[model samples]
Target: MTTERRVLVYGANGYTGKIVSESLANRGIPHYFAGRNREKLEAALSIVAERFGSPVDAEIAVASNNPDELRPLFAKVDVVINVAGPFMQMAWPVVETALECGCHYTDTTGEQDWSRAIAEQYGQAFADKGLLLAPATSYMWSAGALAAEIVLENKGVDSLDIIYQIDRGLPSEASTKSFLRMVCNDQLYLDLNEYAAWDWDTLVDVHVPYRGASIRAFPWGGACEPIWYKDDPRVLNCKVLTAMGEHLIDGVKMAIDKFHEEALSLSQEEREAWTNTVGDTMHQGEPPKDNVTAQRSCIIVGGQGQTTTVQYVMNLSAPYTWTGEVSAEAAKQLLAGKLLKPGFQSVATAFNHRELLQTFHELGFTSAPPAPGTL
Candidate 1:
């Protein structure tokens, strides 16, 4: 192991990637801003320098998942925070290369299928090498898992109901692409300790504590929690539901339901091609600064056991900003030699919940006191 630890932020030119890079720069964490385009990476670095009011003294590397090209970059870095998404199409090669180079791997993926693939296929390999393979380390899944862990508190909760709500704000182009990809894929949830296909038509009404209204939410796969809590004997069921602003729910659902039907009618190859074209066209540039500054996100977890139930809520501003904060912090912990047992881990599994929550609290995130609650 190198005495001095270093990190590389791959896909540093994307909207979320730029935020992650800026977070690391603000913390004075030395990292290489890396991506396939040198020009874009340089442009992102310039913005970071200006925003942080100090030039980031970091190297810029042009590389992708091409092993011969990426191996050298991976060899020099102790950790890689991959913000690139629709991770299903992009994560495999990058992860494979990271493990081959003996570097810790983490990403901001919320895709259930891809996360499970990493855990099942490469978990053991990473464990054997004593390296961490944590995916979904950003706001989407990691924050939810953290909230679940906090509420469970080893209470032996056997079921989890997770809900995510965000105020009206623009999602990054990468996030929109990921959503497009997800719409065409089969969704899964955990039941009785086994994975089952989710019924997209089954929408449940959830009362949003932040918004103070009930919104209908469909089963959004099991997300990363089912994968994280899969083998844990203490948990037997996990379900995740997500919604945007209440006013937008019906329109978004109608669009998604329509797309899902059309996508499922085609062959796998056709679906992939169609989704890519749609994703490209739907991809908007970076969100406006004012939108990000004014938006807020929430994650609510309802944990139930044979005899007990608890609900926990977390509220944070600027989903993209929080994603950047959490990703940068995870990288910092890994670079500082914090070792996890490896094997496809969630943020909670890889790091201390209290420590992570403390960091978030310090960053202005608020958590509601746990108590008996409805929805």
Candidate 2:
């Protein structure tokens, strides 16, 4: 086995993959791009080589969504960063093969069902397979969650809430498609108990801001609401919300929600309904001419600590970007024989967080605002 800490980037054809690879290259980190499509591989590499103005040197391998080819791909690499998402649908084969090959797994998975499924279903298997499966380590959970954890360390963080809002730049046609494909995955709307719970009639609502525009947001998906809160004994209840709240955007997310629920039970009609709805949302971004700006995301973690203290909002960019780098950086550290822990774990449990934050500060990426309530 070559001692080169080989990193394999799946879905190297997607929008975020391009940036992720660029980020890796900008830092002079070596990684291989693997995907099911050959054309995409060639195109992606062409761009990477051109933009970086450096040697075009990355082993791009094409696996035809075939299990046989994927297995060997894993054995050759130490870490696999999966970007091809809508993971609840496209996750299995690659994930299964990666574990079977005795390689560690990590991905930008934001799907709640995907995360819980991997944990409840394959959590032990990954451990038994002697592999570490880290999911939702991207902009969603990693950056914001870690920052939130940092604030709560000694100050006492009993309940945590993470909200992400990134607008201003409209994604390319391809980018928008990938985003839609991701949101089209099965939605696992559950109560605070980790059991099956999806109640739209009653929701956890809060007034937040977007581009200085105050908006009312209700509970959305992904992170466990009450459970995420309840896990930390101090939190009696916790819920999640997003920029595009269900009530706020009636057509897009509402239809997608029904589709995800129906997808589990194999409902074709519901699936079509979701496809159409997403298509509608897609149509709105065809030309990107209007300078589509995004709203700012804020996470208000409210709990009884010095009387309902709320510090930094998790959805802020600088913190999100910083935390995001934490995931891959941490994985790189782990592969280098640094971080090691088995079973299901959030970003907070990943490393000596102070060092992690220091890495971000050193890079001069994103940062928190000034001290609050300090005269």
Candidate 3:
């Protein structure tokens, strides 16, 4: 990518946004910060300068929901790395503004409904403009999707079972709010190449090698993989399952069940208010700790067909840190004209899967053996 290309980190003041900004700075990518708070944006820039020993390009106070405030800056930028969360509520306007300004778009969203909506509603628009709309390029989903792509490379591998297990780390307030908003309804997955609903109350016992046995996992939001693979002609079935940790799985499941149960009687507005209330109680405005030393997570994707079976694994630590690096790398690749096609995409579909895996490998994100079809 050209060093002269401009990138804008929207929501630059948020917990994850600062990490993304740091990644961009480390890569020497030219970028600026934009957010609704002038003080927070300035503070973010100061943090970057203090950490890197050099000041960032600039910081602009712009309201994300205000198209008037966004249009000018977006029109000037080559790419927009949106770190804003609870994307279902805050992402559309930015996505619209990016397409209007002809800038590529990507975000750290794990909301399945949001991804499906973006693809169904705006996918064609982005393609028409030759721009991209890659959502959920974060660890929760994209990392596992990468593993699925690796397994798919093996011929005759049709169905996929993906799992995400996080053994440590606490949630940020924004992330907690996003989770509360999403778990209030059933999540959908691709079943035999068709949409299938996942009842929020059930859990699946699946094998996780790290655990050396089966562990209970939920189809948390069904993730973005099924959506990414829904239209691909590859073999049929896909299901995604995840768990915070064995210790917390039951509690997490109970909370989800409670939300879904209570939401049945509540109006839409009331459900939202209830979600905010519970989310605030759970997180209490705490910034998540980057405890890589204690962080133990696994993204396991396995594919089974009549005559073939394949599995790919990714052991992770501090996934939020990985999210930051992945966002910056994706923006760089897009600016370098490395995308497979425009419009709604997952990481594997949007860019070369192996190339991305290699990038992560070099950065210490992957410790597994080479994928079945790779050299």
Candidate with maximal TM-score:
3
Give lDDT tens digits, candidate 2, residues 128-215. Answer: 7556777776755565555555556534445555454444433344434334444554333323434444443223334554344554
Q: Rate the local accuracy (lDDT) of all candidates.
A: 0.78, 0.56, 0.81
Best candidate, lDDT:
3
Number of backbone clashes in candidate 1: 0
Candidate 3, which segments miss by more than 4 Å at Cα? 1-5, 288-291, 368-375
| Superposed Cα deviation of residue 215, candidate 2 (Å) | 1.7
Q: Write the per-residue lDDT of candidate 1 for residues 1-375, one digit (tens) a residue.
A: 233538988888888887888888767788888899989998988988887788875689999767888889999888889988778888788999999999889999878888888888999999889888998888778888888877778465789989987777566777776766664577787889898877666567888885556877755544788888887887899888887566556654665676776776888678767777776776566776423456777788888998888777887677777888889888888877675566578878788777878877777754543333332
Instruction: Give the lowest summed-lDDT range of ten residues in model 2.
Output: 286-295
Measured by TM-score, how close is model 3 to the native structure?
0.94
> Which residue segments of model 2 deviate by more than 4 Å?
1-5, 169-198, 201-205, 208-213, 224-236, 244-273, 276-299, 305-310, 314-327, 368-375
Task: For candidate 1, give the lDDT of residue 349.
Answer: 74
**Model 3, span 1-375: residue lDDT tens:** 355648998998888888888888778787878898888888777876776688765555566567888998888887888888788878888988999999899899878888899899999999998888889878877888888878888888889988888876566777877777777755888888999998867687878885677778887777888888887899588988887777666766767877867776888778867877777777756555465677768888888999988777777777888888889899888878898988888878889888888887777766654845562
Candidate 3 residue 305 Cα shift, in angstroms, is 1.4
Pairs in clash, predicted candidate 2:
143-323, 167-294, 168-293, 168-294, 190-197, 191-197, 225-238, 318-366
Question: RMSD in angstroms, candidate 1?
Answer: 2.9
User: Per-prediction TM-score, please?
Assistant: 0.92, 0.76, 0.94
